[model samples]
Target: MSIQPVSRERHAHLRWKGFSSFAFAASTTLAPLAAAEISQAALALPLAFIERDGHWSMAAVLGLMPGQNLYVDAGGVWLGRYIPAALRGYPFLIGARADSEPPPCIDASSGLVTPGEGEPFFDEAGSLSPTVTQVMRFLEQTAQSEATLVDACETLASFAVLEA
Candidate 1:
């Protein structure tokens, strides 16, 4: 997915309209299934712990092939207790910049972004609107949580607990 940095200077007028359907249009599977809290995932979707390339992770099996998601219906409605945070934070993502800390970016292909529609990204005073701020916070928290999960996985691997 092509992601561009979200900037007031570049996207001062762009607004993010709500998504009309499930945003996992690019993948059939969601992996590394760690969230801010992993227990919350168990209450919703079934998870499979897997080891790949010497690293262990979890995944939620969504479907059997590309373009098919069992959790979403034909009308693009989600039919699960919890949507994956990775998917929920779609269009908006944390990506590393060339010379600065990672910044929140927007997927250009996502139809939610428009010039004159939906919720305003920035207020009249050139500040982020509540929606944008919330998204940014979510991305930041998700990144930190994912890092913790990775560290935990690595610790387990160090103990020879994960099978390759």
Candidate 2:
């Protein structure tokens, strides 16, 4: 994916047609779960604790093998009743930038993006559109909550309360 930070200066003309399929996420074997949505996701997915560099994060196990997602069907549809928050925010991500709150980014190569014929990123007033603003807000909230969950998981690991 050609991920690039979104900015009015760079992508004012770009528009998002939105995606109709979950196929874009089919390559992943795990999907990160936001704390707020974990209960719902757990009802439909097996929860797994992923460890990296001694830090822990919770995710939904999508498949047993690498590069495979069992929840997404061959037709590009999601089979689960509760989708992970990380997968819901498709083509958009909160990119980390040093010490600052990360900026929202988009996959410019995601076919959903276009110069015309979709939801515009910026309005004629040169401000972010309401839709874009809402998406940004959701992405920020998801990232913040997931970070908290990761910290909690790391603490649990440190105390030996969580099993590998």
Candidate 3:
């Protein structure tokens, strides 16, 4: 997916329309896995824990096919107890910068974004609205957790407990 940095100058006038269905996720082959520290909270869910290329992750196993998600109902609604934080923070993502802190980025193609509709991204004062602030916080936490997961996986691989 093509992601662009979210900035007041660019996105101030836009609104987050909110996704009406899970069709976008249903079409994807895989979803982002929770970090090891947070995986236990989702253990009872229907997803499967998988480790690939030294990265410990999870995947929703719908069927025997490559790209299938059974959790998606007839109306494209996800039927699971815990939604992956990655998916919950739709459209917005944390992107690493070359010489500055990572900033929240938005998938330009996501249907959740619009010129006029739904929750406003910025308030009348040209500042981020509460909804946008919450999303940014979620993305920040997700990025930090992902980094920790990568480090933990690397350490495990060094000890021969995980395969690279």
Candidate 4:
């Protein structure tokens, strides 16, 4: 995949308690791209870190509106350890079509679908009802599949929000 190079000098500083980190956080800029890719509005914008080249690399694929606790270090050293936590509490999704079985659920209202199953869910902001349970069963039966329940949950959550 081609990536555009950014710069540390142009990065923003995020202050948390007595500690501070430098990174970039912009949902408006990348959210649309993700939405287009996933074909859902409930895509999760997982945490990302600024690489040495100043380009962005996702630290982790956070599920639907996952809390700040899910945020973790991107496994880097020194100054490069900094990662943008702004999206920790923000909403993001996989923004892609499911390639596995037990397809994610969707909110008829929002017209968005969860990325997969076994993913996290927030409040009504992103909820999965009967559909979620079915997805769960599918995940339990499948083994060694690249697909994750979390991805399905993210897909459903995305759809819910889109309908809302």
**Clashes (N, CA, C under 3 Å) per candidate:** 0, 0, 0, 28
Model 1: worst 10 consecutive residues (lDDT sum): 23-32
Q: Which candidate should be chosen as best, given TM-score against the real structure?
A: 2
Candidate 2: regions farther than 4 A off: none
Instruction: Give the candidates in order of lDDT, highest first.
Output: 2, 1, 3, 4
Of 1 and 4, the candidate ahead on lDDT is 1
lDDT tens per residue, model 1, 1-164: 67898889888878887677874443556545655757887788777666755666676767777566788876778888877777777778888867987877888788878888888777888887888889889888877887777777778878988756
By lDDT, who's the top model here?
A: 2
lDDT of each: 0.75, 0.87, 0.71, 0.28
lDDT comparing candidate 1 with the true structure:
0.75
Candidate closer to the true structure by TM-score (higher is better), 2 or 4: 2
Positional deviation of residue 109's Cα in model 1 after best superposition, in angstroms: 0.8
Per-model C-alpha RMSD: 2.4, 1.4, 2.8, 20.1
Better of 1 and 3 by lDDT: 1
Runs in model 4 deviating more than 4 A are 1-79, 90-115, 120-164
The lDDT, on a scale of 0 to 1, for candidate 4 is 0.28
In candidate 3, residue 135 scores what lDDT?
86
Candidate 3 global TM-score = 0.80
TM-score each candidate.
0.85, 0.94, 0.80, 0.15
Candidate 2: worst-modelled 10 consecutive residues by lDDT: 48-57
Q: C-alpha displacement of 146 in model 3, angstroms?
A: 1.8
lDDT of 2 by residue, 1-164 (tens): 99998899888977897779999988889888778888888788999899865679899999899999998899999988888888887888888899887888998888988888899988999888899889889999998899889988988888998877
Name the candidate, 2 or 4, with the larger lDDT value.
2
